[model samples]
Target: MKPHDVNSTVHEPSWQIFLIFLRLGLTSFGGPVAHLGYFREEFVIRRRWLSEKRYADLVALCQFLPGPASSQVGMALGLTRGGYPGVFAAWCGFTLPSALLLIAFALGLSEWGEALPDGLLDGLKIAAVAVVAQAVWSMGGNLCPDAQRVSIMVVAACLVLLVNTPLSQVGVIITAAIIGTLLFKPAMDAPHEALPFTLSRRAGAFWLALFALLLLGLPVLAGVFESQGLALVDAFYRSGSLVFGGGHVVLPLLQAEVVPTGWVDRETFLAGYGAAQAVPGPLFTFAGFLGAAMNPAPSGWAGGMIALLAIFLPSFLLIAGALPFWEALRSQPRIQSALMGINAAVVGLLLAALYDPVWTSAIHGPADFALALLALTALSSWKLPAWLVVLGCGGIGIML
Candidate 1:
């Protein structure tokens, strides 16, 4: 929907947007990095929910903040179009499909066969490589347009590889936002997502209340309700609320939540996590993976569903509530500097994440490295479809 369409634009009703994101939630792939590429394709480049610049600002902001960057970005993207409720719908839609699949898959891990159907997982991974490569290039073009900005990315990349920092992703982007604002502050006359003031404000408040209720009252409610499902939900939701970087951070949090409890074994958790990296949407989908796979009380697909929703709900609320405020705030010189520093720091964070988790997990041998290089080449130069590459790679993976 066009921005001017009061009825249809980004402010799309919660239910309506739920469906759109639902499809995307299921299909988006390549992890956090790849998810950005998919998001640009669906929302910025194709759907025109917001302008490229606006989307960049939103992305940069989320990257700098301490949270799941992609999921936060998704929530912010929806907010840009529709406000608080828009954020709610986008998250639900984006989160649901994958959560459901992962939860279901998790429940029957033993029965899931030695491997995925020929070429499926491989294809997804290849597609992911392509998608991330594309995002790297595209973001480079838009964000690193200036020589100075380019320097920031290059330096940030080095920091990530060199420092071996644990949670420096948040630091990288925050640093960039600050630098950007200080050195090259821009005017704020640029286009913005149209918004409805009163409704948006009210919706924002509602989201906050919902989040607070879940956080404070949930434990008590769970104990009374005799629902370990509530405990899982609380755990996941708290994880979502506390993390300071992207989805990978969820690993330690989730491990702490489930492992000591003897729910899923180490192997199962690792395997599920590795597999999750290949799926689309948020890394938090791992909630589904564990929720179903573990045989905890009330665990199964049902627990998986509850866990998935609980974790993502707060993101939707916080993002949407902040959207209206961000439009004006981003234009401020102070905010701009902060954003510049933040974005630069985000580059560093991405660099770190790419190495520690994404690269190490996926590329095991020379052959795997070669395949990854090939996938990157396809993404960077050929513009081949992500799905096709992923399919081809999955075939190779099973065989290898």
Candidate 2:
């Protein structure tokens, strides 16, 4: 099917896009992998905003880039659906809920934190395991159909597990692309479903240039001016720009940036992180908490907003800049073959993530495993909404 045929026949207004994503923002729990599952269900399966292949392609692209993969995908979806306005709307809708919650936690709301049962957060983590498992199972089926692709997926997963670093993930992707180029061949006349991006190459180049300029100039500007705000931007921007795997991989980088500098105390940082897990948006929004909790000036809501914007800005610029060029290149037969490998590798990466942080942290005993299975059944078999399932799991966790 053509790309346009797969998407909504009518272009949605930015407000409508915001509303759609706001619902997602309020409900999407787990982490980045689970977020992808939620997005696939909403856009690909429920709303028919894009085809399965197109969504996978977008995932592959975002995985290759730095910053939060899920948020970048959200931004690209918004861009595709309603142009630039939609991009901002989607980001705000999906991000603000968690960002605000974290900021509140930083600004003394954390004192009341013990009100919730301890099981609630544990339940949420268990639900995330189910969500990520669902994503891996479904995407693995679609993207790794052939033996060559399956082999690529297995090897990629093994490599990611063994190496377990942000740069290692990038290496896996690059290696997958090379292997795909060698192993698969596509017909020259294969049908290409062009992404519905209104951005021109010239505009894309401009965005890319801006991204590079900021990446190079921000630290120098921070050092020269010695402004706390500039330094905050520099720290956060660099953290966002350098992170490859996103999600939890950002933690060490952020800790390094904030802790030793004495911007936030270690206890406050750890507390905000715990609070962040309870919220329902991108983990990158932890930047909001750190900013608000900073000992220096520009702390509070103002600081939170600054850190939030600075960290996510790269994702905006990178997606905007890369899409036009990426779209054109992906239309080629050779590139399509490479993407097949890359997509399979992406599935492998998800699989590895599912095993490590999602599964290891959540599944402590038989009861925890049973809860995850029940959540999975609710998601896959009963066709219950993810938000409902997550809540149910949390309740079950309390009981268990």
Give the whole-model CA lDDT for all candidates, comma-separated.
0.64, 0.80
Model 2 stretches with alpha carbons more than 4 Å out: 1-10, 109-192, 328-400
Model 1 residue runs over 4 Å out of place are 1-91, 113-184, 191-193, 200-287, 290-299
User: In every candidate, how many clashes are there?
Assistant: 38, 0
**Alpha carbon lDDT of residue 49, candidate 2?**
87
TM values, all candidates? 0.64, 0.66
lDDT of 2 by residue, 1-400 (tens): 1223223334679999999999999999877888999999999999988888788878977976778999999999998877777789999999999999889878873455467676866777787777667767877887889898899889988987787655576678778888888888876644546665556667788889999999889989999999999999988997788665556556655765787688976546654655566689899999999998888989999999999999999999998888868866655667767777777887788788678656767788999899889989988899775657777877877777
In angstroms, give how far residue 28 of model 1 lies from its true place. Answer: 6.5
TM-score: model 2 vs. ground truth:
0.66
* Model 1 poorest 10 in a row by lDDT: 1-10
Error of 1 at 175 (Å): 5.4
Residue 81's lDDT in candidate 1: 58
Residue 4 deviation, candidate 2, in Å?
A: 18
Residue 71, candidate 1: Cα error in Å is 6.4
